[model samples]
Every structure is written in C-alpha cells, then in structure tokens.
Target: MLPALVERYDYDPYGATYIAYRVPSTYDDASQTRDPNLLTDPAAWQPCESSRFGNPLLWTAQRYDPAVRLYHFLFRTYSPTLGRWMQRDPAGYVDGVSLYTYVASSPTCHVDPLGLTYIISPYQIEALIAELRRRPDIGGGLRGRTRTPSDQKAPTNGCSSPFGDAPSGVNFRGACDEHDRCYQTLGKSRFECDNEFYADMAHLCLAYASSEWQLAECLRWAMVYYIAVRVFGGWADLYDFLKWNGHARRNVSPLEPSRPAPRSQPPYTQPPYTGLGAGTPWCPSRRSPYGD
Candidate 1:
C-alpha cells in the first residue's frame, strides 16, 4: 500500500572519493522491481574529484582552471603542485609578509574566506566600541552652537565633521528636515534610524580602520556626523545638543555608556564561518547537528 523509496551512492575503493549518485525514486507495484536502465555505468558517473564545481571530498577547492591546472580558493588561487598561489594577494601586504603567500603560507592554521579583509567577531566589535568611547573627539562634550546658510560655503573633504571651527553651510533646520525624512522613509524611529546609519557607516569604515575603535570613531566623526554638518549646516550642533540632553541617547550605548556593568556571559557569540566574510558553512542534511 506504501510506495518503495530507494537511494544509492557509489564511491572509490578507499571510500573517501565519491563516484556517482543515483536519483531517488518511489515505486508502487511488485512488478517494478528492476529497471534495466538503472545499471551503474562508469562513464555516466559525475567527476567529483577533478570537477570545477562541487566536490564532496575536496571541500576547499572551489573552482578548477583546467588550462592552468590551478584551483580557486577563497582568498587566493592555489596551484596544487606548487602549494602556493599563482599571483600576489589583491588585498596587498596586509600581514607584512610575502604577498604571494596563501594564508601566510600556513594553510593548516588560517583560512581567508572573502579574499579581502579578516572577519570582525562580536568580541572585537565590543573592544572597538569601547576604545571609540574613550576618544576625546568622539565622547567629548558636544559643542553648543548653531549654523546658518551663510556658513555653508566652506570647502569640505566629505569625510570630517562639518561643525565647530571649520564651519560648513549645514544649517540646523535643514538637518532636522533631513533626519525626519530619513526616519519616515526607513519606517524607524529617529534614534533607530541613526543606529542603523551608524552600523552602515561602521561597516564602510572597517575597510580603512587599522585598529580597534578606529572604525567606530571614523564612522561617527568622519562620515555620519561629517555628512550631517556638510548638508544641514548647523544640524550637527543640534543633534549633539539633543545627545547632550539625553533626548537622542537611545540605542547609543557604544557611543556613551552610563556605567560599566559587572562581567557576565558574553552578550554576543561568533557565528560559524570558514574565514572572514566566508559566510555560513555548508553541511549536508544528514550530517547536520540540527537535523535535516
């Protein structure tokens, strides 16, 4: 009364190399025991070992260039025989070693997922934010002043704060209007939108950040606050004013923490990833710890 289901996989003698896989099928009748066309054929088997794409046995080998006989790894292209990359790292001399080295020529110890920058863990994020809060340019008391349209003519580098001594044309009223527009468009509270904007700016700043908190400070003073003062003229002062009065302090813990709390379990955990920016790891349904 129930349909019969069958699945099969064939591999090499060592059992480590995959050979072929048969599509699962359901049969209902007793006479359907054998399908002559289902015989295992060597030529019909998919090439799992040398193929360009999916190779169950070789998880690290992403792509194959048959012409060059090189396999593409995440951060670099690797030559199997040479045990090195064919070219130097595009990220330049990030680690101050040989540019051609793959994972510092230590494959067993390191993995580069995006071929770009190293991944920032949650702990690192906390450390960076803490350092940012200590900076005088960041957590220092706000400058209580306003700007007018006449003050907007100063040239700006498009990256630093437009307020204070280096006055820009950004007026306070325009800043308010822009903030409201961003809040309405994003469908978030003004504070929430500011937090999201900070996150985005922080992500961008990471590319240029050399140390902890540098990225956060860069985002705060160089990008977000800079743009605000550049466009709204004096809105930067008003925003700081609001911040000083605690009206704009919601969700700004990184920028200003009232007091340090006693240590407990870490608030964040690192997600499983092969390397920086590598994203989620792939595991077969049957082998997954969470179940199929």
Candidate 2:
C-alpha cells in the first residue's frame, strides 16, 4: 500500500475512507474557486486546470486564492475506487465540508484521537490537518516558497520596524538611516520580511494549530490568553491575574504535608511578624496542649 494520510468512518455501509497525499503532486496556489453550489450540487463541479504539483483537475475556470480552492482541488482530483464515488452527506463534512462531498467506508461515526486507531509508525495526522486550513492570499508567488533571510538585502535601518519605536531592536547598524529601517525586527526572519514585507506568519501558525486533530480546542484559548498577557504589560499582569503572593513557597512538595500543621502553634510567634525563632531551640517546657 502507498504511504498516505487516511481518514476512516466506522459506521458507513460502504468500506469507504479517504487517503490524501497518496500521489506526489504540486499544488498550484492560484486557479482555485469557492463556489458553494459545487458542494450542494455535484453537477456544479466541472473540470478544472490540473496542478502540476497535485492531482490534476478538470479546468472549470481560472481563479486566484479562492476560499474553496483547496476543496475544489481535492474533490476534482480524487479518483475513488472502481464503482464508487465519494458520497455526499452531512456527516462527511470534516474541515472542507462546506465545499465538497463526504465519503465513508462504514456507518459508525467516531471522533478524532479516541476514534482513530491502528495508525502506522511515524505519522502525524494533526500536522497534515493544519496545512489544509485556508488563508487569504493577498499576494502571489510568495506564500509557500522557501528562501534564505538575506535574499532581499533591505537596509538594516529605517522605518520598516513593526512597532516603529526608535528604542526598538531593529537597529542593526551601518545599513540604513531612520527613514530606511530594516524589517527583520518585526518577528520574522531577516530574509523573509526585508523591505517591509510580511508573510502572514501569525495566521499560518494559528491555522496550523487549529487543524491538528490531536490538539485540544483549549490550546487555542490558551494562545489567546498568551497574546493578551503580552499586549498588557506582559508577565506582571499575568501574575496579578494569578493572584500570586510574593512569598509563596517555591519548590515545595504539596504531596508531602506542609512544614507546619495548622494546629501546631503557628510557625513563628515573635513580636510583630518576628515569631520565626531564628537560631533558637524550642523549650521542652513549652509542650503542646494536644501532646506530640
């Protein structure tokens, strides 16, 4: 069997499932459309241009970064086994459900993680899901391609900083003046963002996290919390929200009872918070009323 990404349905009458990346094909970032009728009405799906990198599709028309481009490409290129086509059903909608038909091999419905069984070695289904999330492409030929950081040779100094603070870390020295600031200080590689260019890195990270089948939804919430903390005075605000006391014991074991039990005559009884008997031995005469 070809090494592929698979999704199975346990309850379907037909032993139907999906296998992605079964064939090696390049995906064209352009020429995709988001027509809804194609999903609701299979007849609406016509031939579209075949991608040299991915399974080719019949050419319906040309488009650039359409919302449903990924779905259109997958369904149009998918070649099911003989005598069977991907069935259209409400349950089949996983991620791209709004734009394509759902297929199943059995009738039993199951959830992610706990539902998926018998995965082969060295497989990560969540990462694959993350890559499938659609992001709006405002420009062309610069999204997924790779390059080194110093490719653009943008000026090391100027107005390219994201925060635009003169005290900011963008000053690389000896490259440009304040009017020609370098773009590397904006949280991207020096090569990726040179000349004030942005790559939608944040959206891409969010999409990757959202698509993972194994990652819980709470992770997304935690990310939101993390962002909020950074925006509003960072760790100080986070600590305040946590109600952390300055003197909270560090490295203490909760499993092993605390140093002083509540009934055992408080830790220190010195004058005005001076009860801590430093370098003094407890007098035997001062026995507890409750005995040892």
- Top candidate, metric TM-score: 1
Instruction: Please give each candidate's TM-score.
Output: 0.26, 0.17
Kindly report which residue stretches of model 1 are placed more than 4 angstroms away from their true locations once superposed: 1-49, 52-58, 73-76, 117-292
Cα-based lDDT for every prediction: 0.35, 0.24
Please give the range of 10 consecutive residues that has the lowest summed lDDT in model 1: 283-292
Candidate 1 lDDT over residue span 117-173, tens digit each: 222223433443443344323311112211111123333333223343112111122
Best by lDDT: 1
